[model samples]
Target: MEVLSHFVRVSISEYFRNLPVPDSFVGFARLTGTEWLTLLPFVGTVSLLIYVTIQAFKAKPVPEDTKVNRKIQKESSKVVNMVDIEDLGDKVSYCRCWRSKKFPLCDGSHTKHNEETGDNVGPLVLKRKGAA
Candidate 1:
């Protein structure tokens, strides 16, 4: 192990010394300050356009009856589920993550949102009103 480590270290040093690094930034030095200044607005405009297009696509309409909506968030780590209980006694368990402590039911465990960073939405609970 010692011999192998020494050989690897010596080989790496010799390789770098034999083929020294060149001034890779020479290409940038060729461009004047005006060139970079001109490029700044182009880059900013392109970035803004991309951001707007993505945001427009992200806000696409969701149906009233759909149970799950996907690709709504930037990071999209959490799921937004709208469970439909057709019958009076039917049970619905909206599990954002299967790691819920409440098993099939959501115990607010998804608040952590899979440890991802972004805006998150929780499950939707719909209850119809009946006249007594």
Candidate 2:
């Protein structure tokens, strides 16, 4: 492990040493020659390329849970029931743990879910006495 760590440190130092440095910073912090100033353009180009590459590969930020929930509710199927009166037709589907492939309904998907997550969840079925 010590040898591996030493090799990593040496490799990182060599890699950083090869990275472009601004011409103004090439000399010692105390005293320096200005002849390297001509390399400023190359330094800027290298820095810009690095910045763009990093940004391109970065994952997009995720939305907050509340915002995500609101969006999901907007897109999800709705089930409403009427009370105190007889109706001919009404239906309600329950989404067990919101993991249903048939949203708000049971499609035996929970069996697979139980195996994977060790969760004991089941769907609820609702029926209305009358229709709207």
Candidate 3:
């Protein structure tokens, strides 16, 4: 193991030493005013494209039915309702269809919606541990 390690280290050092080195390094400092000006538009375009791509990926998706009717305007607001688990019973049925009179809670309104639209949308039923 020691011999193999020494051989590898020697081989790497020899390989690097045999590599050709440039007499002068090309950098921004070596560029003329004309060259810098020519590169500015290309750099700006690439930067703009990168920024737009990042923003597109970071953006959250908006739902198609975001515009609610005046009747359920308050219920369809951006504000989140915080429900206390202690206040709730063992089992709860949350509304999947927007026609619920109780807003978040299911009041069998999806049945009427299903009958009207011929859709099979139902409630999001939640059950607590060991609650029959």
Candidate 4:
């Protein structure tokens, strides 16, 4: 994107003055009509990208969520139980403890959750025989 943007800013369109472009860096010439037509796809892709980028910068941001919007979002959010942890057996009477500060089994609370998306609960089962 940066390279293409730079090319556009530099106005490289004049390079197409004739089909047999004499750009020093690349010696591409004597290309057939099909070869030239193949370039159109790349040109169209780059043009669309540039156009969309310009539009993105020019377009104003949408209005902030109003109280009503917030309420709706909150209500809709209640249905998300994406991290529902299943039963991890008993907590006590087993005579085992979690290595993590979270204690008990684990929600991976002790593990670094830099990229983990779910609840930081671990899969480690606390090996205990008594109440946790």
The clash count of every prediction, one per candidate, is 0, 6, 0, 20
Output the number of the lDDT-best candidate.
Answer: 3
Candidate 1 accuracy as lDDT: 0.57
Query: Order of all candidates by TM-score, from best down to worst?
Result: 3, 2, 1, 4
True-vs-predicted CA distance for residue 92, candidate 2, Å: 13
Off by over 4 Å in 2: 1-33, 65-132
Q: List model 1 lDDT by residue over 1-132, tens digit each.
A: 989898789975674465423357776666667666755655688799999999988977876634333333426477444434665233343555444565446677567764553537555343456522
lDDT for position 41 in model 3: 61
lDDT of 3 at 13: 69
In the range 21-119, model 3's lDDT, one tens digit per residue, is: 334665666767776676676668879999999998896889665543324556644635578988778999887777888878899999988897688
Instruction: Report the lDDT of model 4 for residue 64.
Output: 71
Q: What CA RMSD would you report for each candidate?
A: 17.5, 11.2, 12.3, 14.7
CA displacement after TM-score superposition, residue 36 of candidate 1 (Å) = 31
Off by over 4 Å in 1: 1-93, 114-116, 130-132
**Which sections of candidate 4 miss by over 4 Å?**
1-31, 59-132
lDDT at 30, model 3 = 74
Error of model 4, residue 13, in angstroms: 24
